[model samples]
Target: MTTLSDQDRARIAAAITEAEKSTSAEIICVVTRSSSDYWAAPFLWATLVALVWPWPLISITNLTASTIYLTQLVVYAVVALALSFPSSRRMSLTPSWIRRRRARLSAREHFFTQGLHRTVNRSGVLLFVSAAERYAEIMADDSVSVKIGESAWRPILDALRGALARNQLADGVVDAITACGAILAKELPPRENDRNELPDKVIVI
Candidate 1:
């Protein structure tokens, strides 16, 4: 994954707000790097617990050494089975002969934010970052991407990256994007009568 500095992410968020079709910020969903941590955290934490707790138990049992060995054997088998099986909470992005796996990697819908291309499908979202003449993509299977537009996103992302430089990702960046960009509540319906304006002039402010 491309590690974006906090300053860079904030700028993308700001640019997103600027690109909103409406002058008044109108958006209902905002997904960011923090969102991935939430989903991956459980698996990460569970691994920690499993590692720390098992050694003491195994060591203590070794002195007395009885059915405890058999018990450990059973526990290990179950863990191995669970890891091999398909589950929603698995925190996986691996390809498999399943609908979810195929859908995430090959999503058809696409959008651009802060010169980054975002593609979405039923399985997951793909973020393609454009830096001058080069490009990179970050893949997350647990996310959904909605392309607002490049103009609104650029400012928002820039501000977010600034927040990162100050070590304010959780505090400043998320709040700024969610509150100023209005990504939690439902936004106004698209106006059928609204006119199209050129992208360059839309975010001049």
Candidate 2:
């Protein structure tokens, strides 16, 4: 997984500051290592490989039943152990729907955990990215959603995904935050008493 350097964090913070200048809506950015551990995938794959271990021996040599069972066990152990590493564990073999679902769920959880839903005007927006899954989600509170339709976020999300594909995560986030801020500025102009309810720092989880 790509960890954010201090410079990346600083850039995101500055972007948030610039974006929030004209908007009452608060923007919260969060990046997580992964959306889900996907432990079952590695185990399932390992088991499948183990199940086939006896096939070749059965076709060629007359190996004892116990020997075949032992070989299968060894195969399972080796495969499972090999996949235990974090990077190997989160392989792309997982279904896309599963990854997307988990990311969306995570985004919703952060929406509350980060206090985006608690803003006075309900105009908070969350820009959530899960690095392991290469997923990005934009969630808006009721007040903001009521004014701006979901389609409006597509352009910003597309730009973020583009940047992510190039390994420019920090830039992508900054661009997305800036785009979100523009929408909020137009729809939920700044209030004289508006305060920074959420931290501007990019949260790493």
**Would you give me the overall lDDT of model 2?**
0.88
Give one digit per residue, the lDDT tens place, for model 2 in 94-204: 788988998999999999999998988888889999987788989999989999998999999988888888888988998898888888899989899889888888999
**Candidate 1 lDDT, 156-191, residue by residue in tens:** 556654555655534443344344335312333234
RMSD values for the candidates in order, in angstroms, are: 13.7, 1.7
Alpha-carbon lDDT, every model:
0.36, 0.88
Model 2 lDDT at residue 120: 87
**Model 2 Cα displacement at 192 (Å)?**
3.8
TM per model?
A: 0.25, 0.92
lDDT of model number 1: 0.36
Clashes of 1: 33
Candidate 2 structure, TM-score to reference: 0.92
